[model samples]
Each structure stands twice: as structure tokens, then as C-alpha cells.
Target chain A: MSSRDAILARIRAAVADAPEPPPVTRDYRTAHVDDDHAAVVDLLAENLADYRARVHRCTEAELPALLARLLTDHGSRSVAVPPGLPTAWLAAAEGAEQHLDDPEQPLTARQLDAIDSVVTGCRIAIAETGTLVLDAGPGQGRRALTLVPDHHVCVVGSADQVVASLPQAVPLLDATRPLTWISGPSATSDIELDRVEGVHGPRTLEVVLVG
Target chain B: MSGTYLGMPAFPQAAKAATRDTRLRANLRHATHTIRDKRARAVGELDDWAVLREAGKRIKDRTLRHLDTYLLQLEEHVTAAGGTVHWAADAAEANRIVADLVQATGETEVVKVKSMATQEIGLNEALAAEGITAYETDLAELIVQLGDDLPSHILVPAIHRNRGEIRDIFAEKMARWGRPAPEGLTDRPADLAEAARLHLREKFLRAKVGVSGANFMIAETGTLVVVESEGNGRMCLTLPETLISVVGIEKVLPTWQDLEVFLQLLPRSSTAERMNPYTTMWTGTSEGDGPRDFHLVLLDNGRTDTLADEVGRQVLRCIRCSACLNVCPVYERAGGHAYGSPYPGPIGAVLTPQLRGTTSAVDASLPFASSLCGACYEVCPVAIDIPEVLVHLREQVAGQPGHRAERAAMQAATWLFEHPAALAAAERAASATRALHPRRLPLGPAKAWTETRDLPQLPAESFRSWWQHHHTEPPTPPEPTS
Candidate 1:
């Protein structure tokens, strides 16, 4: 048997006496389905904001201008762009130096230390949890794009990408893939229970809830 | 014992001993009941709790399915965000990677936030082997470290030790580890905490390297998230010049939006709070703030193996909130040490066996430790259905070829049932021979089962004959027609 087949056989043997697990399916319809995918995205954005994540909404037509404005607002001179980020998003930003370079390729440790902020697209946005998931696809680029930069500006699409519940989300995953789930910016507390922010990931997490 | 449950016998033996400890039973009963009650009230406050729970479970399932893609994406995002990503296949690989990271920093000592991933890898021991000292900053972790004990509970590692035991551990061992407990340390909670703070404070400030584990890692932004009640994690995350995090691959979620679900689920499920006191987030490196160098070690010890099993994969859905531990009757009485791993309680029962592979005597015995009561299912915020997994693991154990004797026993019973005439004859003979039957089986597999439970009293008449004699009246067909 192939490794996968062997694994499956072992699972069968393990659960031989167990009632079988429910079969995977994506057939359940939402009781109150969003009018369209955009409504789902909107709900996701609203819930994200409710969880204290800073949310920004922009149209594809106005994307570049909004991207520039958000960067300028953060007072950033250099921005790390994921390899797969839309070209138009960077087109409007005139003054800032665009960095699509992988830190591993040309940049040394010191060189990467100079860059500020990273912007990319997410794989899925869970509305129920106010979470943004990135599968690091082409437009999403490498994991470093999200980590090395202090400010993370991620784009979320409004249609065909959102799932109402987690049961609706499971069958969509593939185990071998690299998955990252972020609820909010990285944080930790002390012995006295004092709150502190920005330890390792990003101090400020800015989400652009765009269609 | 070298550590918590270090010398304890395999699961069945330890559980048997724990079942008889009246004082231990009282403590576990009181503690678990209180925490479980508080957790329920905390969970009930949320209007969309069921929806949130479903969402959390779904997001985890989806991510695990496409884990390779998400993990690659996470690495890409972290690199893009200006962070270095290292992949470690197992505990040895993870320890080597972390030790190398610390050695690269040229730091002899490292401060740590409470991280189970690190513990699972035995990172501290590994670091010490490299002659690099690791200071545990979390209060409970400090106690465990000073005493050279293994952690039993995920949230409270020292749950097995009462206040008096803590005071003794501190007064006796703290000085050897670092600073001594104040001249006269008392069993008072405040005094113990104060002593720990003084001891850890020096290490936190002097250390050039820090180590941690993230509750969740965002793939989109390459952001690693750590949530804790204590602020020590923040100091370790920031104060050190080099920060290294050893994170399980399963902790990865796809986006920040997905992260929000757990931020809500974790706080209430863990400490029964509307919000955790501290939440630390960082991406890559910041020149002027926190660690200028950041490295994320993605540790995949037994997670991939765990993920491969369809029934067992659900264990990955755990967010490490440890709500199941608070409600488990077995966990409360047996204590975390008896389970013999970092993760104890209901989660430990299913998780440890799968991670370690149910090949060892201890691993094989873990699944049977539970009562098969569904309390864990009801209390689990992520809805892991632990009882179902326990039964599943049990089947796995029983299916092994070594259980041929058991198989033969079952087969004999099956054959007797199939032949009712034989079964009835046997039953009648057994009923007549009841006085001759042994009260308990001789020393062997059935000895434990028969110790407390009594053999059923045989009936004077077999059911077949009793039913045959009692059913003399015929059906009233005329009444039915009317």
C-alpha cells in the first residue's frame, strides 16, 4: 500500500468499533445567507472591527490610491510587497520604494531590518471569529513578507472567498499546505497580568477589507 | 520521582492508585467543579457562542487539510514581513534548531514565556545540554523549573503542588536555580508570587535571547500571536535582543479575521475572562522596538502523523484553551502528573497517545483511563468529542494482533449467542452452578475488573423458560375487530 493508503488503513483499524465520522460535505445552505458574497465580506469586516482589528474598505478601482494613502498615513518610506500582490495596488504609490524582494535572496540581516510594513492578500476571512487567514499563495507571497515588516496591510476579497461557519470551512483545507491564522496583532501578558503588545509578529495589524 | 509522574507506572496502574486516593479525589473534585462551573458561565455570556465554536472548529479543519499550502504561505509571509522561518520535523530537530538559534545569538542564557511546544520538545533540557541556561519567567513554570519537575497541566503546570509544596520548592530549590526565596518565605500566594518575580526579574533583564510559542500564526501577514494572563511573555518577547518562537504547525490559522474567533474563544475558555490581560503580536523585526532579530521555528513533532488519521485529526482543532481539563472527572482525581506528558486531562488522553503513537504500554493504556462519560464533550469549547476518540483509540488497541486471546474470547461469546439452544443450556447450567463459581478471577487481566465489582447473581429460572411459562393468554382478536 502507498503511504496514504497505509495511513487510511490504520485509521480504519483504529476506528473499527467506532461510529464512523460524518462524511465531508459542503451542501448546507446558510439559514440567513448573505444576499451575495459581498454581504458576507461586509459582515466579516464589521465583526473584525468589533474584535478591535483596524478595518479599511476600498474598491478595486480606488485600490492604488487607498494603498498609497494608508502607507503615507503610517509614515512609511519603504513597503514590503508580496510577490503576488496586484500591480495596480503599487502603481498609485509614487513616493514609497516598493520592496517585492525576498529577504533570503539579496537582502542580508541588516538590509531587511531597514524595511517597514508588508501588504498582501488573505486566503479566507472567517466572519464568526473575526479572523483573517492567509495561505501564502502567489499574490500572497512568502511568510516573511508578512513577518519582517512591522505594519501588515492585508487585502480581503468580498466574493466567493468567505465562509459563514467552520463546518463549512473544513473540507476546503489540504494538510500539506502552510496555513497561518491571525486573530489580532501578536500579544502577551506578564506575571502581574499586565498587557503588552507587539512581541514578535506585528505591533500594528491593519486590514483592508476590499472587494 | 525525577519529575511529575516520572516514576508512575503505566496508565492503568496509576489510575488504579489515583482512584483510591481520597484526599486527591477531594482536591480534584473541588478544583475541577469550580473551574468547570466558571467556564460554563463565561461561555454562556456570548450570544453567538455556538456559531463561534463552529467557526473555530471549521477554520482549523480547513487549515489542517491544506496545511502544507498554509504553512508555506505562512513562511512566505513571515519572510516577506522580514522574519526568518525554520522548519523542524520533530522534537530533536526542533531542539537543534532552537539551540542553534540561541547559540547564533552568542547568548549563554535565554528567557522563556510559557510554551507547550517548547516543553514537548524538552527545549530547556536540550538548551542546558548545549550549556545554554533557559530561565522560565511564568510563575508556575518557574516553580516547575526550580524543582526540576515536569509540567502536568497546560495552563497551571504546578497544579499538583499545593501552596505549602510550592513554598518548600522555592525555599529549598530557588537559590540553586537563581535568586533565593526571601529570608522567610511563607505559603501565602502573594509571597510566593513576589519571590518568583524577584528571581525571574534579574534573568529577564540580563538575558540577550528569549524563547516562546505562539497561540496562532497568521499566514497572510506572517504575524505570530501569543496570548497569556501574565505579562512576562511580553517582556520575553520584547526585552531580549533575539527572540525565537517554537510553534506547532497546527497552530497556524489563515488570516487575522480567523484569529478574532480564537481571541474570543480562548480568553473565556481558559481563564474565564471577557478578555485576556495581555496579548503580544510581532512580525519579523523592528529596528527600534522589541527584538531586532526574529526567528519562527515551525515544529511538527507528531502533528502531521496526527493529521493523517481522519478520526484523530480532530485533536488538532484544540486551541489549547484546556477547557476539557477543568471538567474531566478522571483528570481532576488523577492529577496531571499521572498522565505523564505536558498536556494532561481529556485533551492529553487523546493527544498524547496519538502524538507518541499507541505503541508503548503507557500510550496504549491512556485511552482506557477515561470513564466514557461525555462531560469532556460538553465542556470542550472547540467540540473535540473526546469520548468518541477514546472509544476509537480503544478499538485501535484491541485490534492489535497481540490481542488474539481477547479476540478468541469474544469469538467464543459470539458463537454461543448465535446458537441460542447452546446459550440457554449454558445459562441454565451456570445458574445451577452459581455457588461453585469463583468470587473473583485469579491474578491476571480480569483481576482489576473483579476487585470492586460483584459477579451478577444467577436467576432461579432461565429467561427462556420463564417467558415460555408466563405467556399463556392468547390475543383478543374480537376486541380488535370492534
Candidate 2:
């Protein structure tokens, strides 16, 4: 038999003796038992801050202005923009130079080091554990856009996108795609278990809690 | 078996030395207990934990079942997105693929994130053999590399060493690597971090190639994800002109939407935090943003073989959250090195055997390392039945054709029990000859058991015979005679 066939045969034998697996219930209640989306976003924002991610709150109208100002505050000169990023967001940064880069761009170390910030939309936000996920999609650029920049300003819509628990979020995802889950700025406490920020990914992450 | 954990002794012999080290045991116990307790509390905060766990398990299982289809879809998506995917059947193939990719760029050095998959494949060692230097940017990884020590835990590779050991390692070894520690580097956490930051920053700035392993791969979108507490992963991913990610095939999930579940489960289970500090992800590649060139080396190694076993395939469901490791009593005592692989603890016990095959002494002995305790099960975010797998592997060992003598002995015992009359006669004869019995079995297969335990002395007479002699007379007749 072919190797693949042989593998399948062995798997069959190994699992053949197993008691049949319990039936899977794909039917899940996803109506989100949580009462308020804004409340959940608030909790998530609060938790993100706890992990040292700079958190900002703004209305939809103020989002672009807030993002531009935040980028300026970080002294960002060239901001990486995902192709699907809200044009309005960049339009607000009228004076800030923009580098519309895709995730797969090949750039030199110094080149990436020069880029100041990246802006993207989030896939989902978990309130129970203040975390945000970016599936490289519209608005969210290639995963690198989030990683290469010193600062990341992610905008999360306060709506049904908020999930109270992972169980509620599982069925919503397909396993075969690339998924990036962000909880806070990349940091490690490896040196004497001393927490240090920005060894590889973004050193400073800013989340826009847009209501 | 190549350069990765080949010629490693059986788990028992390796654990023997580790268990004897009282200080090591103390450190391991303290670290494991603290992490495990904190993890328990963290998990306890979520009411829907069981549901989440079940979902995680099912999602992984389903994805594994249709892995080929998903992989094809992922490849299509990635290629369309301007990324290249390479399939590697084993470590040799993976190393060759990655080395060739790096060579194509005419680069001799590369930055690396903390990746277990890369370690499992012995990528750095392979690259070193190819005359390319790979810099470990993760702080713990740096310490492990500088000290020439094996990682002892999943989350904390250097948990066996304390602050002073780290300072000593940095003071002595930093210069040889490239950057030296600042003069009079103290054991203070801040000073140590600064030293590492200064040391790794140089590599990050100079390296033209980056290597990493993904936490997850989305098949639908052809995206690879790396979730780490350290930002070094991001640096290796983005700063380098070329990024090569060596990912295990089992890391694949179906779609981007599926990332949400794992994001919640991984952090709390691993670092005992509500969320991970950093998560880096990328598809094939994009122009004008990050690394313009991206290579995803999809590594199978022994995963497909492992996946064939239904009882063992559950290992693939593991998110590498390492909750099981933190709670493992065996791991707490013996530490990670005793497992003799990149993967350790309860997961390692079952997984290594399946992935590596139960052929070597280390692989064969791993099944017996565990106490069959189920604490790993309780704390596992995905609920892998580790003890059950260990026992199953033990049975597999006992049932192997090489154990002919043992099988025969068990068969003989079975036959004796099946023939009760013979069994009774044999028992009576043994009882009658009990005084002739030796304290220990001499020159026999049973000697090993007899050496540790004494045989019970026989009764003065067979109980059955005594009952027959004394109780045969009727009570009324006895009373009349009196």
C-alpha cells in the first residue's frame, strides 16, 4: 500500500477499538447571552490596558481623527496601510505620509524599522479574556502589517463581533485559514523572568474601541 | 532520529539522574506547582470552559480528518495571495528546503522566534551544519543556547535555572555569540533584560533571513499564525527580507474565524493570562509591507503516522497551551529533559512515542514515565486522555512479539485458571510443600518480583482438608457421644 493508504489503515486499527466517539452537536446557541456589546467592549478595553496595551475610546466619527492623532503622538512618519483599510481612516491622516504595504512585502530590516505604525480591523474581540483576533482580510492587511510596525492601532467594531467566550466563537471560524490572535503587545519575561516588550513584534499596540 | 534526540537513553535512565538532583527537583516542583495553580484559577474564571474545550477538540479533529482538502485549499489561497508553500516529509527535507531558501538569498545568518516545531526538526543545528548561523531572539531561548542546556519546560525553558545561573551564563557566554553583557551585569531582572535586549537587537538589525514556527495555520485562507509572549517572533517575521516558517501540518485549522476559540484557550492555559502578549500571523506574502518573500514549509515528519491512530490522534488537538505540562506531577519531578524531546510532560509521554514510534529506548520508556495520574487531564484545555494513552502504550509494549516469554507466562496462568480441578490440585500440593519454599525465587523469571517481596508461608494444613476432617460429623451425633 502507498504510505498514505498505510497511514489510514493504521489509524483505522488504532481507533477501531475505541468506543465510538460521542456524537458532535454542531447546533450551538450563538445569540450571545451577554446583554450589552458596549459593556463587553469596555471590559475588553479594560483588560487590554491591564496587559499594558494602550487603549483609546472614540465614536465612529472620531475614529479616523483619533487614529491619526495617536499615530502622530507616537511620532510615526510612514504608516503601513492594509489594502482594505477604511479609506476614511487614512483620509483623516491627511498630513501623515502613507505606505500602502501588503503583508508579504519584502523589506530590509532598516526599512521595516523605519515604518512607525500599522492600522487594521479586527476579526473578533473576546471580553472574557481581553483579546483581539485579526484574520488577514479586508481592512486587516497581511499579518506582517500588524507585526512590522512599532505601533499597531487596531479598530474593533462594538457590535455582534464581540464574543463572551471561545465556545461561541469556534463555529464561526474555519480551521484551514490563517488566523492571528492578539491579546497585547508581544512581550516576554525570559530574562530573569523580567517582562520586556518589543523583542520581535510590535512594541507598542494601541486599540481603538470604536462604539 | 537524525541530530534530534537520537542516541538518547531511555526515559528511566535519564530521569534517574534528574530525580536525584534535589535542587533541580525543588525548582521544578515550585515552578510547575505555581504555574499549575495559577492556570487552574485562570481556567476556573470561565464558566463555559468545558464547552470551549469540546469545541476546540472537535474543531481540531474535524480539521485533521479533512486535512488534505484543507491543505489544498490553503495552498491555493496562499499562492493566490503571493506566498509559496513547500511540503516537507521529514526533518531532512524540511532542513534542506529551509537551508536552500536561505542560501538562495545569499544570507548566512537568520533570526528565530521561539518555535517548538523548528526545534523538533533540529533546524538550527541543521543550519549550523550548513554553515549558517541562526540567532535565537527569545530571551529564554538565548539563555538555553548560551548555557548549552536543553529546555526543561514548555513555557519556561530555563525554569530549572534561577537568576544567578542566568547571570553566570550571560557573563561567560555572551561574548562568544556576538555581543557581551554589560560590565558587571547584575542578577537583577532589569539588567538581565537589558543585556538580552542589547544582545539580540544587533542580530535583529543585521539578519537578512528569518525563521519561525506557527501556532496555527488556517487552511481556508492559507495563513500561518505565531502566538508568543515575546515580541521577538514579530521581529523575525517582519524585519527580515525573507521569512521562512516551518510549521507542523497538525497546526492547521479550517478558517480565520476559527482563530478566536484558540486565542482564548491558549493564553490562559499557557501563561495563566487572560490573553497572550503577542500574536504574529501572515499569509503567503504581501508587496510593500513586510517580508516580500514568504515560504511556508509544511512539515509532516511523523504527524501523518501519528494521525492514523484514533486513540493517539487526539494529541493533534493539543493547542500547545501546555496546561498539561504545568500540572504533570511526573514533569514536576523529572523536568522536560528527561522526556528527551522538544515536547514534554504528559503530552510528551504519549505524543513522542506515536510521533517517533515506540522503537527506541527513549520512545519505549516514555510510556512508563507517568504515574498514571490524571491531573493532566483535569487541567488540559483540550481534554487529552494522556494517562489512558500511556496505559495503552504500555499494553502495546507488553503485547509485542518480542515479549514471547511474558505472553506465554500470561497464557499459562490463564490456562491454569480455566482448569479449576488442576488449579486446586496444584494449590494443594503447593500448600503442602510450602515449608520447602525459598524466601526468594532462585534463577527463575519470577526472581525479579520475589526479590522485593517475600512469599507467604503455607498454613499447617490445607484449609479444605482440615474442613473435610473436622466438619464431616453431624452435630447431633457428636452431642450424643459427649
Candidate 3:
């Protein structure tokens, strides 16, 4: 028999005497934050900053100026623009060369590595854990778009795209689509258990919460 | 559990030497205490922590019992999503599969994410034998691989090394691997981390094969989850052209929604973070993103055997969080190396013996390494009664051929207790001879148990005699005042 068959047979014989496990009792709260959207977004911002991620709150009309200033401040000459991103998001940031991602001709890993910053809209922002979930949806080009680059300027819609907890976020995401749940800029605690931010992923994560 | 751990001394011998190394003890003490306090504070933030833990435990139990069904489902979904699936009955088979896959890609070098499953199987060594060099990218894993050291802790394999030691290792050994450390490398954590970033960035950009282990696998959708703080995981999972994940079958969750419970339980119980920096979830392969070629190897080295034991099967409920290890008094002192497996501490005590079996000296000695303080059980998110399993394993070990003396003593005591007259006479005789009792046992076999602890002092009189003397007649009941 094949290894798969053999393994399944072993599992069957082992669990023969075991009873079926009862359905899990998921009494845990689905949402930890209050229902107020503004408060939830505030919690999200607080958590994002707590993890050492730079937080920028701006109105829709002010997002372009904020993105432009952030790029200039970071000395980024080139920025990766994922497909379907609002053109207005980077209209004001004309100084930086924009490389728009084409799914038909996606940039190679080396090419992506050379880019200085990536600006994209996230599918949702989680408050409880201070996480951003990018599913390669419209504006979120691909898993590697936000990765590989040194800086990430994510635009999260505070009005509709913020969640209070993991339970609230998981159901909203499509498992079939690749998902990247980023809580902060890359970090490591492997040395004396001290957290040192910035590693292989984007070293700087600047989240712009726009209403 | 793998070749690297072959011929390891039993827990008692290894732990004996570890305790003598004051430096090792200090490192373990500092690392474990810091994480333990942080974990408690993180878990305290959620009022429904108990419920979340309960849900996590149940999800794993349910998944394990119906693992075959879910495995079939996962295979179908993965195949449908443009990925290939392989099955391995043991570590050797798993290693062979991975080696063959990497060779088929015609790549001599591969990058690795820190995975307990791969560590348990010793994948890097196995690949080396096949003329392949696997690069470990996680900062802690890189430290262990560079120093030619076995991982001592699960979450932070280099937990035994302080900042100064890690800095020295990197400065001395990094050049031989790829890029050399910076000229003026210091012991500062931020500096060390930055040095690693510059060193590994070159490998990530040019790598063609990336091997990893998943934190959780969603059976319904065939999505694999890798929870990590560093972006090494992202680099490995995304940058490579051929991505291979060698995951233990037990890591599979029944449904995607089941992720909610474990996602909450793991981060809080582990590194004590509200959430890790990155949690990458991928199902099979995306058309233009990640690796176009994806492979999932489901490993069942001794998990099936572990599942056969009703009392010990709960060890499978572990999410590799390392919370039990952080809270364990024995782990705090004995250190992780003494466990003699990739897994260490309270979970290792029960898990190693079951997965590897009690045939080896180290495996047999593992069950007796704990003090049964129940601290591991109290902090276990999955509610594994580690102390209970330890005693159960001790019973099994005692039934082995070498423990005839202990079994004989237990049988004699059992008989003496069954006969009331004989028991009373024996107790009185022991009380009378209490003055002659030695503070420590002279028997060599029992000395290990008594060395760290003092044998209890026998009372002057047995409780039976005291009860007779104090209550010869039943005391009259007091009248009700009302």
C-alpha cells in the first residue's frame, strides 16, 4: 500500500476505540472592542503604534499629501504601486518613480527587492491584534508586493475595513485567496528574547488610516 | 527524536551536567522568566481566555480523531489548487521525500523557515547527506546552524545563548556561510538583528527553493499558516520558485474558521505578544504570486503511535506554543538540552517518550525528570495534564524489565496495605525504628529521585494509633442554639 493508505489505515485502527470528539464550544467573544467604528479604528491605531509601526490618520482628501510626505521623508525614489490602487493615492507623490504591478507581468523577486516602498489598500484592518490582512484583492497586488520592499505605506479604510478581533476577521477573509496578516514591521526576539524590529520583510511599516 | 539526538544520555545524566553549568542555568532562568511573565499579562488582557483555551483544545481533539477524513479532504483541495501532496510514515521517509524534491529542482542550496517538524526530523542534516545545503533563515535557527549546535528551545532555539554569545557566534562564523558580519559587531540586539538582515537579504533574493513548516493547516481549504515575528518566513514562502512545506499531520485544523481559536491561543501563550508580526497563509499555489510550484509533505513519524494511547494523546493538542516550557520549574533548571529532543520541557517530558518510545535510555528517563508541580498543566492552553501523563509514563517505564526492584517494592506495599493487622504492625514497627532511618537513600537506583529532595520524616506514631488515642469514644454532638 502507498504511504497515504498505510498512514490512513494506522489512524483508523488507532482511533477505533476512541469516541468522536464533541463539537467545540466556542464561547469566546467574537468581538472584543465596542461597536463604535471610530473607537475601533482608534484601538487599531493604538495597537499598530504599540508594535512600533508608524501610524498616520488622514482624511480621504488628505491621503495623497500624507503618502507624498511619507515617501519623501523616507527618501524613497521609487515606490511599487499594486494594480487597481486609486491613482489619486499617489498623484501628489510625483517625485518618486512609480512602478505599477501588472499581474500579467508581475515584477521578479530581485526587482521587487530593489523597490524602496509599496503603497496599497488592505482588505481589512484588525483592531484587537493590530493586524492588516492583504488578500491580493484589487489594490493589494500580491503577497510579495508588501513584502520584499523596505517600506510599506498601507491605506486601511477605517470606516468599513476595520475588525475588532481574529474571530471577526477570519470569516471575512477568503481562505482560498493567499492572505498575509501583518501586525507590524518585521521583528525578531531570538536574541536574549529582546525584540529588534526590521528583518527580511519591510523594515518600516507606515499604516495610513483614511476615513 | 532524530539522528542528531542519537546516543544522548538519559534525562537524569544530561540534566545532572546541565545543572552544574551555572551559565546555562542563568540563561534559561532569565529567558524563561521573562517570557512567562509576559505571557501571563498578555493572556490576562482577554477575559475569555479560559473559553478560548477550551475551544482551542476541542478543535485539535476533534481534528485528530477524524484526521483521516480531513487528510483526504486536504489532499483533494491541495491537488485542486495546483499543488502536490506527499505522505511520510516516519522521519526517514519525510527526509527522503524532501531531499528528492530539492534534488529534482536541481538546486544544491535551499532556505528554511524555523520549523519544529523539520527540526524533529533533522531535515538539514538529511539534505546535507544528499549533497544539498539548507540555509536556516530564522535568527535563532541561524544561530544554531552557524554554531553547529542543536536547538535548545522550541520558540527561540538559541534561548540558551545570551546576546554576547550570539554576537560572537555571528561575528566568528557568518562569513563561512554567506556574507560576513559587520566589522564592528556589538552585542546590542538591534545591531545583531540588522547584521542578520544584511547577511540574509542576498540569499532571499536569489533563492530558488524554500523549505518550511506550518504553524497550522486548514483542512477544509488546504491553507497553511506560518506564524512568525521575522520576515524570514515571508522571504522563504514567497521569494523562492519552489516552495515546500513539511508539516506534521497533527498541525491540521478541521476548518478555516477553526483558526480563530488557535490564532488567539498561540500568540498569547507564546512569545506573549498581542500578535506576531507576520502570519502568512497560503493555499496550494497562486497563479502569478508566491511559488508556482508548491509541495506539502504530511509527516507522521510517531504521531500515530502517540494517538494510540488515550492517556497520552493530548500531547498532540500542543500548538508548539512553548508556554508549558516557560512555566515549568523543571525546565527552568534542567534546560532544554537535557530533554534530548527538538521538543523540551514539560511537553517534551511526555511527548518525547511517546513519539520516540521508552526503548532508549533518554526516553525512559524523561518521565521521571519532572517534579510534578502541575505548573505546566496550569499554564497549558490546551489543558494537557502533563503531570498526570508523566506519572502514567512512569508506570509504563516501571513495568519494563529493568525496574524489577521498584515493582517488587510496590507489590509488597500493596499487599501490606490490604491486610489491616499487618499494616498496623508494620506501621508501629517503622515508627519504633524511625530514629535509625537515614536522611537519604543509599540505593543507587533510587538515589536520583532523592538527591534533589529530602525524604519525608516518618511521624512518631501512625494516624491509626493517634486517632484511637484521641477519640476512643465518639464525641457528643453540640445542641443547636436556635
Q: Which candidate's TM-score is highest?
A: 3
Candidate order by decreasing TM-score: 3, 2, 1
Each prediction's DockQ? Answer: 0.04, 0.28, 0.84
* Interface C-alpha RMSD, model 1: 9.1
Candidate lDDT (C-alpha), each: 0.72, 0.76, 0.91
What TM-score does each of the candidates earn?
Answer: 0.67, 0.77, 0.94
Kindly indicate the candidate among 1 and 2 with the higher DockQ: 2
On residues B371-472, what C-alpha lDDT tens digit does candidate 3 reach at each position?
899999998989998999999999999989886766887898899989989999999998999999878788776776566456899999999999989999
Q: Each candidate's chain A: what TM-score?
A: 0.76, 0.82, 0.97
lDDT of 1 at B373: 90
RMSD of 3: 2.6
Q: What is the number of backbone collisions in each predicted candidate, taken in the order shown?
A: 91, 38, 0
Query: Which runs in model 1 stand beyond 4 Å of their true positions?
Result: A1-211, B4-8, B404-442, B449-482
Prediction RMSDs, each to the true structure = 10.9, 7.6, 2.6
Per prediction, the TM-score for chain B is: 0.89, 0.85, 0.91
* Model 3 ranges off by over 4 Å: B1-3, B408-443, B450-482
Write one digit per residue (lDDT tens) for candidate 1, span B77-107. Answer: 8887668888776789889988888888777
Docking quality of model 3: it rates as: high
Cα deviation of A171, candidate 1, in Å: 26
